[model samples]
Target: MNPTWNAIRSGLERGVIELRQTFTTAQDLWGYLFPAVVLLVVMTVMRDSEVPGTGFSLGAMALPSVLGMNVAYGGLVNIAQHLAVEREDGTLLRAKAVPGGMLGYLVGKIVGIAGAVLVSLVLVLVPGMFLFDGLALTGVGTWLGLLGVVALGLVATMPIGAALGSLFPNARSIGLLFLPIIGLIAISGIFYPVTSYPEWIQWIAQAFPIYWLGLGMRSALLPEALVAAEIGESWRHLETLAALGAWAVVGLAVAPIVLRRMARRESGSSVAARREKALQRVA
Candidate 1:
């Protein structure tokens, strides 16, 4: 058997094992459920309110945007978190020591993270469909569009996460990423209309994959009449694809180079040093 094929198979098995662990482990289960509960609560609180220019429930308008934000959020943060922690713990070094181990490691991480993203989506979408009044869950096209948006969102974000992870000196450094991410979410209109922002801010938001992902999700899930509340009274599926596809291309191009460089730098001594620093911080 080809070594690459062997690595892929091993990676798939690892991914499945980790995905199964998501259901079994207390921390993983909490990670999924807590956010869902919070989002549900907030949406419920806003159930009676309306979008700025439309009679649609503000909660309903937000449901799909929040769902799309989840995909982007999890893809970027989870993968980066896992990579940072694992690198500090010597996992990357161990993988680097083996034939095609780095490839297998990445594949497993992507699969596991993607599966986790889907689980998060379902936890929200299943309940939101019942609670939210304006969702267009009645057709095959809507469902297919949702899936397409999700796939593209994952592709756009995960590789960038990997690249960022490789740059982090330790797991604690991941905390610094949060403030910027929060700012992005704020402007991306996860819970409000992007059109409400100034034209300059709106242009900045539209430049990123997060905004496009949220737009795609809204396009798939919200009623056609809700377009009036959007920036240009349109879903602009083509613009969504172009923006996300550009991100996908850039991430795919950069991550492999960065990961390879990071892999080359990983050594047992480096891992041990990082562990020592982490312990000293604890002490």
Candidate 2:
């Protein structure tokens, strides 16, 4: 077998192992369910409210948006957190010590994170289907569009996460990312319609992948009439593709350079220093 293929296969196996571990580990299982449970509670509370013009349940409309948000969160924040923590723990340095290890490491990270995100989505969606009514899951087009949106969303966000992770000095600094992400969720219309927001805020929301991902999911899962609640009153699939594609192109171009530089900078002394800092914090 080719060396690169071997590395990739090893990475895939690593991902599978880690994914299984996630199910077995109590903490990991909680990490997976906590957010889903909170969102379900909120959706249940909002079950009676209706979307502005449509008679459909507001919780039902919000369900797909939440799924979209989860995709962005997993692709961006989860990867960033993992990379930062692993780097501090000397995992990246260990990978750097081997010829094809970095490739395998990255492949493993992607596979593991993507699998976790898919499982998380299923956890949310299955309960949502029973709790809410009028979800547009009838046609083949809906499923295909959803799959495309998820693929594009991950492509657009994961490299950016990798770049951000390389830049963050330690796992503790990853908390800074949460504030902005929460702010983006607010503006991205995860809980409400973007059309209800101010014109400028709507534009800002549209500028990011989160909003488009939500809109894409909504387009896939909601009735056609609900488009009245969206900005431009259309799905804007072309713009969604263009925006996500642009982000993917730029991130793919930049992440490798950033990650390579970060990896090059890693050393025994640096890892030790990080460990010392973490110990001091614990003390």
Candidate 3:
């Protein structure tokens, strides 16, 4: 077998193992379910309210948007967090020691994260379909568009996460990323429509992938009439594709170089030195 293919297969197996593990333990299951539960609670609270001028349930509108946020968030933050924690724990160094192990490691991470995200979508989407009344879940087009958006979102985000993870010295610093992500989510219209926001805020929001992810998802699941709540009163499918594609291109281009650099630096001594630094800081 070709060495690269073997590595990818190994990674896929590893990913499957990790994906299963997430659901087995109480803590792991809770960790995965906690955010979903919170979002559901929020949606429940908003269920009584209506979108401005539409009489559509505000909570219904938020369902797809929140799904989008979950996909993008998992792809970007989960991978980065894993990478950082793995690096600190010397798992990355172990991968570095094996031929094509880094490739396999990345493949595994993608698979594991993608599986988890898909499960999350199903968990949230299924319950939401019953709880909400306005979702457009009746067509093949709806399903296809959703699949496309999710695939694109993962491609656009995971590499960037890997690249960012390569830059961080430790997992603790990843908390800093949370604030900016929250800020973006606030402006990206996950909880509400972006069309009502000021144009400048709209422009800023549109510049990032999270907004497009939310928009793409809304385009997929929301009714055509609800387009009134969207900017330009259209789904702007082409723009969502273009914006997400740009991010994918950049992430794909940069992640390899950064990962390689990080791997090259991950000698035993370097890991020991980093561990020493952490211990000394704690002391």
Candidate 4:
């Protein structure tokens, strides 16, 4: 067997093990469920409200958009946080010492994070189906479109996450990203129609994958009439694909260089210094 293939297989095993652990550990389980619960509560509060200019339930419309946002969050922030924490703790350095270990580590992360995202999707979706109305889940087209968007979203965001993780010095620095992410979500129309936002805000939202992912998911799950609420009264599938593809291209092109540089800089002394800082904080 090819060594790289063997490493990937090992990574797959590692990812599976980690995924199982997440279910078993109380902290991990809470991490997985907390977001879904909050989103569901928000949706419940909006269940009676109608989407602007439409009779459709606002909660129902927001459900898929929330799912799309979750995908973006998992592929980007979750992975970035994990990379930063692991690098500080010497996981990346350990991988650097072994042939193909970095490849294995990365593959493991992709698999694990993707699995977690899917689980979160199911958690929100199953409950959402019971609580919300007007979803178009029965059609084969809906499932296929959803699957495509998810795959594209993961490809588009995960490498950027890795690169961002590499750029950060520690887990604390990743918090700075949260403010921008919230701003993006606000402008991306996750809870409302983007068509109603200012033109400049609309343009800013369209430039990011979060907006496209939400748009794609809405295209999959909402009735055609809901397109009236979207920009141009269309799903804009081609634009969604183009924007996400551009991010994927740029992220994939840049991640390896950044990750390699980060790995090269890792050493026993650096990890120890980080550990000492953490201990001092705790003390």
Candidate 5:
């Protein structure tokens, strides 16, 4: 095997071990459930009205969005923050001393995040079925499409997260970046349709992967629901597939450069300094 692949495998193994140790802890479970619960409550409360022209209940409209949000949180923010923190805290350096360590770390993270996302999905979908009465899944095609959307969306978004983690290389900086992330999520049709935003904001939102994820998800889960809305007609599965592919290409292209630079900058001394700095901040 290639050295990079071997390193990645090693990293993944370590990441998995760490995840298994931490998985299902109160914090992890809470992280998975809290947003799901909020989404459930909002949808249940809003079921009475048509979301604009769509005769679909708010529950139906929100289900796909909730799922998309889970993907975003896990594949993007969570991956980015955790990687950056680890890089700063010396864990990444410790792994780097071993062959295939980086690979193992990332693979483990992906597996862990995927696991958490699955848990969150069940939490959202189970209650959504009863609470929303809005889940009207059509056929095997919908299931396949939903899977395609999730997988493709993760591919498109996770690289950006990885790139950001590599670029920032510090937890404090990563946390600061969340401010803009929040704004992007708000405008990106995760909560409301992108068309609901002004023309300029709509254009800006289209540039992000979250919008594509939401659009792809809506295409999967609410294909018929689209018939009643304005942008609904534009929610083409082919376009979603194409957009996700394009984003994945871009993310893959850009992320490695950042990671390479980050690796070059990394040193044991820097990690120790970062740890000390972090401790000072906490104190």
Candidate 6:
């Protein structure tokens, strides 16, 4: 037990190292930076509109949601996609061979991804405060709620990410995997309002974690934005909390099963054969 715990710690430390290495890699930075630029451009184009009450500007209303979306994209989607590639390349197998390897590796990733999200929030907030005229962080309660939403959002999404990583085990397949999620985000009112969508589509969006995270953010940092909603007060908060909690529960339960199956299937020769086949197919 002690050895396993130590191994977990070591894997976590190694994961952090891996994440830092990724930042230094030119391709990784380029991939993330391009989308960030696009988001900034779009936000700049959309910042002139007025938010409901509280005199908050459109930038202020949109800031929290954008932050929520970025965290989801960067933390969950990015991590999962990268892990899939790594797993296919036997990176996970290598880690599993070390002491407390898998646990440590996962812990390190969770911490690293959380750090990445915090950095992203800061990058967005600093410019947001200056460029936008009406921005505020009213009270401690609101701030706490924001923290809660971020924390909960990570917990809910990470397991699903791990499950996806374990299930798809290759970069090409993983790229294909992200299309559905991206589409969901579009339909979930990230870039637009959910009300604009049909009832069934709204229901589908509500079933997913991203929408609930956005709703929780809209509830927390942008409380005034919630007033225009048709639902009653207690129900909305309860609904947001319930949906996120339920997804977290289900994802957490399923992640281990998927991971165990992946572990069982992993073999050095099989990985080599797959890589060779992929290369051949490409050629």
Identify the leading candidate in terms of TM-score.
1
Could you tell me which residue pairs clash in candidate 6?
7-99, 7-100, 8-100, 11-104, 11-105, 12-104
Pairs clashing within candidate 4 = none
Candidate 2 wrong stretches, greater than 4 Å = none
Cα RMSD, each candidate: 0.7, 0.9, 1.0, 0.9, 2.2, 2.6
Location of the lowest summed lDDT over 10 successive residues in candidate 1: 201-210
Off by over 4 Å in 5: 1-19, 223-225, 230-232
How large an RMSD does model 5 have? 2.2
Better of 4 and 5 by lDDT: 4
Q: What are the TM-scores, per candidate, against the unseen true structure?
A: 0.99, 0.98, 0.98, 0.98, 0.90, 0.88
Q: What TM-score would you give candidate 1 relative to the actual structure? A: 0.99
| lDDT per residue (tens digit) for residues 195-226 in model 1 | 98898989989888889999999999999999
- Looking at model 3, residue 187 earns an lDDT score of 96
What range of 10 consecutive residues in model 5 has the weakest lDDT sum?
A: 223-232
Error of 4 at 272 (Å): 1.6
TM-score (C-alpha, index-matched) for candidate 3: 0.98
Q: What would the TM-score be for candidate 4 when compared with the true structure?
A: 0.98
> Model 5, 1-283: lDDT tens per residue?
7888776666566657766766648887677667877878887777786677667776677788778777876778878888888898787787667676666666877777766676777788777766665455768988898888888878888888888888784887888777887888788876666677788997787777777787777777775656455354567667677877998999889987877678767898899888888889899
- By summed lDDT, the worst window of 10 consecutive residues in model 3 runs over 28-37
What local lDDT does model 3 show for residue 105?
95
Ranking 1 against 5 by lDDT, winner: 1
Query: Which scores higher on lDDT, 1 or 4?
Result: 4
